[model samples]
Target: MSPTPSHSASRLLILITAGFGLALGAQAASHDDEHASGAHGAASSQEEPKVIAKDSLKQKMAAGKAAAKAEKSDPKAEPTSVSMAELRDLIDQKIAEVRAKQAAAPAVKVVNKSPKPRAVAMSGQVKQSMAAYGAAAVPGLPAGHDLHWEYTGTAGPQSWGQLKPEFKTCSSGTRQSPIDIRDGIKVQLEPIQFDYRPTPFRVIDNGHTVQVNLDPGNNITVSGRRYELVQFHFHRPSEERINGRQYDMVAHLVHKDAQGRLAVVAVLLDQGKEHPMVQLVWNSLPLEKEIEQASPVMLDMNLMLPEQRQYYTYMGSLTTPPCTEGVLWLVLKQPATLSPYQLSVFSRLYANNARPVQSASGRMIKEGQ
Candidate 1:
């Protein structure tokens, strides 16, 4: 049977008291030897007292352990002095009891607190389409070039020349178009023969302007030089100025000859009655920029022209970037009319897309009679 804590304490106390008694007797014997030895033993006596007391306690502890072993062999012997091992076991048992009591107490729950976040779910088709779109958007460059020009920004007309070496003419060219056609020599110039046909067309909002692409068949003749009509586009607040007067908008009919020479016809527009030709083209306005929308019916290019065929002619360069020289420019004298509603539609898309007029540099402009 195991002893209770009170019984363990009593046995420990008896052993400790007997050890003290043994230590005191040894200490007395050492003092007597010190007196006999006199001065020689004085230095040694100071250190010997503690050593002798420690040895006497160790001897008593040994004797106590032997008695504990003998008592254990007997069937009904009660313990007197506790051995060192038995005292160690008693102390360990008390420590275990204290730890057990503490473990029995109620525990507290430590909660983790944080803000909940919103979850976004994306489908597989959406991810695949996005990946394909990124690959197709800018195919040649794969990665779009930073030098892409715009109507108004850091990449606007003013900075076009610096953007790329090919576009340097935008700022440095001498014979740029859309000049203020002022102080020109009025002459009976050779009439421009329009051979326009009712042709199918496609319109695209090409980020910069609403451009119309026509099927090949239409052609225009001027000065015996035949040039086929390719495509045409409009600009707000005409790029060209007539005797210092600026129109509301302008349409540029672009053409190219067999020899690769180019001729452009400028049809100026003002806000008034709605134009059928302009309405036809605007009806097919593409929903997305850079994407083309084909018109259901064919377009008669003649409806795009004014009744009077007289024009102000000049030898100039392209108005937009890479403003190459030697192109024949024929600016119509009569302005076309577009309705206020029609004008508003185009204006919403491009509030201001026209480039500012360039310097004439004393170039000769012909006003046809």
Candidate 2:
């Protein structure tokens, strides 16, 4: 007998489901066999490890080490891929670049210790000290406290002795300047020789006094020796140690010999008519506030000479502080005349410019006589 259509379909579905179950069962059985084999191998290895003695195990380890060393020693074992030459070139290039960079860098420099700060501080202190004293207290000058232009009162020659310690001659020294020319002693007169020429002139207000610069061509010859005129200036009450006395006004003629010896000739000026030289200096005077340009005008050195060649000679020092010693002093016996106007001009500029007279100290005051 034949089955029905529905029963046939149902039978087909059951067959399909049974085949799928069978396939899954087969795969499980295969996996279990693989796991069992792995477990058996592990257990067998552990059971067999007791076969080796301790010494034998050590020997086996040594043999293994030796085998590793032999493999390392084998020349052809490792592939020769890395090139030593390439590595060395790369290292050398890096070293050269480092050296180049170092050379291009700036060199290290040291600084100098500057002295300007110390010098400025010291100068300030000196100025402060001078201000406190009122008058400038230079070493080796008269000690009078008052400041003057040239002569009289505080600026007079009499006060020089009390101004400073170094100017002791102001009181004690006997050979002083600006002495009155009383009577001329009879002496054989020699013609005064004058050698003057046109030369450049320079004038300066020197802060302390008016200094006239003379060129080298101007000179004076006395007793066959040549005395080069260096410079000439004015002093208030003259500072000449003649027979030990002081005068009203004086002109100092500074001369230097070839050997560098100094000789100063002082010409005393009395209150009288205006002298030609005085007028010349006053006419060319620059405006009070400004320094005028110096002109190359003819100056007659002879005009300042004494009418009577008679003179008093002595050895002395500069009356001014820093009183340089060893000066040959020659005070003319004759006096020059200066008008009140000329004297007033100088007084306007400097009322007390003269240094106080110094002591002669028994120095030999020789007369041409």
Candidate 3:
């Protein structure tokens, strides 16, 4: 049936109003869905970056707060869109880059602080015994009680006797070494019978002088006693004098007998020819003091002696400690020549190792033929 115009209009208006309400509800729902998706994406992006950018935690937190404030101020603004997975990947990449940079940084250096090495000093049984024998005789010192002596200062030759009771003889002994041979008793004495042989030698810088220890082969007969050579050493500015004249250097060949008697032969050194043996010894000098160095090369003691074997004989004490008396001394009359260079080597080590001439004390010096 055909309806009236008013009825038709009312029905049409009702339909139109219902459709409009439905359309408005659909639009509101769509907006809500879009806002929810954007919020979820923003949360995911913020959380991933916070976890990955832990190295810059403070900066990330500040940026996230600023974005949240902007979103709150403009609710209708297209909710800031972000890809969660892409944000996570970017954060990880930045973290890896930061770690690589840290690893490539230069390392810190540490300085070493340690003490420097000191010079070596003489310490041996033979050296100790020799030092004890160097001074004037005294009450035997307690065993192993080593005393230190030097060329100058308090422990020098002048104060040796006072350094220890064992060195008393240095001050009281009548027959001392390095006497001035001003006037010798012109008696035809027996010549020194040298039985020196070629043998290996071990040298040592014993703080006082350069001492050479030889294999047991050399021997010398003086007066009625046969002495076996044990070792020899040097002293700068010949210890023994001839008519009050001092030479460049002197070598003392120390020897012992079956009865333990000591004998020393002094070969005075003068400035002249180059001595091969002296050069060898100087070349082999140890870099550090008190150290010993041995050579396999055979050395002949006779080669060190001068062609003229005439000598001056006397009863004296050891030039160095416990200046023990009764030592047989043979000071060669003619001096052996040593090149100036060789002399300088010894002088650098010991500028003046010679002890001053002791008082002759009315002792007789015999001149040998």
Candidate 4:
């Protein structure tokens, strides 16, 4: 029983590839080396071309890669004289000939005799989630289907919990964030020690808000714990309120400690004078969502804050979905100013992305004296 041409070609190609010490360089001298001053070399050179041509497209790609790598590593190696298009044309011609041979050959019939498997019932969790939201039934469903959630419409915050089982905390959590800072007990509280400095930043319009991710070294120390500043983002019509009054916008500076404990500093924004920090971030806004725009200039975090360090503090959850509680919220009392134009720029992108304030629920809030 003799092997087919395809099988024989594949085995020969494998053997050649395994001992691929010599490179197929671009220099004419390298091509000459293939047919060296020996009977053994001359015989190999004659059979090599036919065997290489019969190989599959995968092997051709591998050979092309090997040639490129050899040329790159060797300074004496000449640049590839052939273009990728020419190489592609040569490969296509060989493929067409192979296809023509197959087309001329007689076809054979083969049938599978395996029986069909039984149907499985859907789980109660997935069934409930799909029934509640009319979502697609797919494997590894967390709660709702893998549908993208939004700030408005059917996929908005109201339907966040029902949309996915994992986001159930968003609706069931008792200590959720962005609560109205009213009736807070005034007391002598430790001032949060800010250790911010000028650092390189990357701006991104992440579908929901304009977030600025900063380099390491910027952090804050409060209540005897030091939390590193991860990133900060802007929300229109501010999520949290001070004495029942909502500001124009808010900057949530999120931080985390070594143990993954979270702390958020809210810098409320109002329409007045132009803000240098806000303008710097807006300057680096990407043309499309999810695309990050890096800035050449460094940003000083101190410019983002107000002169008055007085703040109101409380324990709450994140303003967004999967509202996990235990977050330490520090809302700056004196609101920062951004010009009317600055406010309008953000409004155009996200007019109302702020979540409505949640219940204080007898949570004790501390107002810095």
Candidate 5:
């Protein structure tokens, strides 16, 4: 007896429904194994049915189609429609199980990987600062022979002439600076009329001395000529001597006129009270050698002078290099005062920088009577 069309359809539908139920039951069993292993909690089981419905249904349908194709002996064989609600519920359980496992695992922390700061050496930092200033390698030396001279040792004052031919006058000049101002020819010499005012200044650690370059406003008129104050620098152990006595330090206020002739006023420093102008200059000195540092303060040449108007005058050469001659010198008889602390500040930088006093060589030194 052949079956009716409706009956055949009902049987095929029942088979398809059974197969889908079986696939869903297998997926649920797999999730139950995970639950037993304590990978997922009770809350995961409650949310399982909503997590993975669509993907499970599609997979089950693909499986049914494959089965129908394999059993093609019946000409009317086709895939039966099976509701996916149960299959979805089963897959959702597996998804919930995976999510719960992720929540329970220990979390990983990310650490920062920034680089460490580099250390800088003090000497190297000073070198860099000096390089920025385009500082000359040698201080207190001529441009070409910047690196050749020093206070003592090979290029000391004794060998300065031998260091370079241009410096021959350093050893051979007849009239040199820093002579003992004794037994001077007394005369009614005119007093130096100082026209000094506050001017901008910069200090330089020239390796040989701390030189202060000033703005051209200060002037001194003596012997019928005006000399513009150019610069002033320090030398320890007083360059000039009076009655065979050397003071603590001396400042050579170098000046020049429009004709390019040089004049220097030597102010001898004796250890006594604190000098404000000297303090200002020392405070502004640069840490590195051969570097120039401009001060915020202004200096007056008159502040560095003594109350006495008497001075010993002579014609001489520059105490430093090229040893050029024809410089007019005025050594003030009264010494300016500086504290012991002030003297130490310079002594630390230059233990000794004074040029040895040369023979007067029959030079006529005129004293203001």
Candidate 6:
């Protein structure tokens, strides 16, 4: 309101000039701040080391994959093939060890076997041969006659045959007898000298025959050999073939020498008078049956001899079964007399115990000429 136009113009010019100078100062200060901040940031970035890509990421990844594949391809890295070969070798070694152990064990052995025995067979020719041998083996038995005993029933002829299988002939042979002694060639002979004496006597009812035992002193001399008498046995229906005749009863005198050789003398008995020897045996007869014991009495054996010494001699088998050969037979030509009572006593025990005559069967029957 107070100043003129020219003054106002000069004042405006001054204000404008002041304003322009203030603006210039402010812009300069802002520029300094910006430059300071930018320098600090650059210094911090330079303090820390910067990372630069020397190799490509793709190349690094490819190298790692290649190393893994190599590991997989190497045979030593895995146990698959080695483990299988080692296991097979171990198994084979174990098998070899087992075989060796078996081979080291002990060996075994075996035992032996044994053999069997044979049996005997008999025949008719065998029987005849046996009979002939028996007759020849016995020293005093008579020839041309077969002497034997009979067995039957409870008192049968089978027992005698069974005593020795050789005696089988007694049971089987035919021509056995209890005949009448009627036919005989007339021949002169020495009278039997009887030396009858009493000694200890024993009687045995042997299953086959009634055996009378005498002491060792009793004996008979024939063909210059003195044979000690041992026992006497009876055969019913005497088994002697006298001129082909058989008798009712026959007595056998069994004797043994020191050498154990046997001689049997046979005597025929007929019904007549009381014989001294028969009487003695009957008087001492034991009550017990099938008993083989002796009584305390002396027995006289000479009394059992026949009145005549003339005899028929032959080789023969025992008239019993299994008729063994090798017995010498002697049959006195003369017969001894027995009373009815004596005959009855013998008959009571064994009525008709007799063996039939066997075939002389090409055997030589000789008379004591």
Residue 101 of candidate 5: its Cα lDDT?
A: 56
Write model 2 residue lDDT over 5-86, tens digit each, in one string: 3353344334433443343344445545566766565544443233233334445435434544554577664321112222
| Candidate 1 runs further than 4 Å off | 1-147
Residues 201-292 of candidate 1: C-alpha lDDT, one tens digit per residue: 88877667787878889999999999988778888989999888899999999887776567899999999999999999999998877666
Best by TM-score, which number? 3
For model 3, residues 97-204, the per-residue Cα lDDT tens digits are 645654654431111212222111222333444555431112222222355877788888999888788788888899988799867888787788999999887677
| Residue 101 shift from truth in candidate 6, angstroms | 53
Candidate 2, residue 167: how far the Cα is off, in Å: 9.5
Stretch of 10 with least lDDT, candidate 1: 110-119
Tens digits of per-residue lDDT for model 4 on 1-369? 233533534454444443331222222334565666665565555555544443533465576556546555776643241333334344455556556655655542211222222112324432333222221233222222234667789878888777777778778889988899999999998899999999998877766778777788999999999998877889999999998999999999988777656799999999999999899999998897766678999999999999998899999977776566788999999999999999999999999988888899999999999
Q: Candidate 4 regions off by >4 Å?
A: 1-147
Instruction: Choose the strongest candidate by lDDT.
Output: 1
For every model in order, what is the number of clashing pairs?
0, 27, 10, 3, 0, 51
List of clashing residue pairs for candidate 5: none
- The CA lDDT at 330 in model 1 is 94
For residues 2-72, write the lDDT of model 5, one tens digit per residue. Answer: 33544544454455454445545556655666667565566456544533443555555566455444444
Query: What's the TM-score of every candidate structure?
Result: 0.60, 0.49, 0.62, 0.61, 0.61, 0.50
Which 10-residue span in candidate 3 carries the lowest summed lDDT?
111-120
Q: Write the per-residue lDDT of candidate 6 for residues 261-326, one digit (tens) a residue.
A: 556778889888889867778776757654445566677666777656788665665555445455
Provide the lowest-lDDT 10-residue window in model 5: 109-118
Could you tell which candidate, 3 or 4, scores higher by lDDT?
Answer: 4
Total backbone clashes of candidate 4, pairs 3 or more residues apart or in separate chains? 3
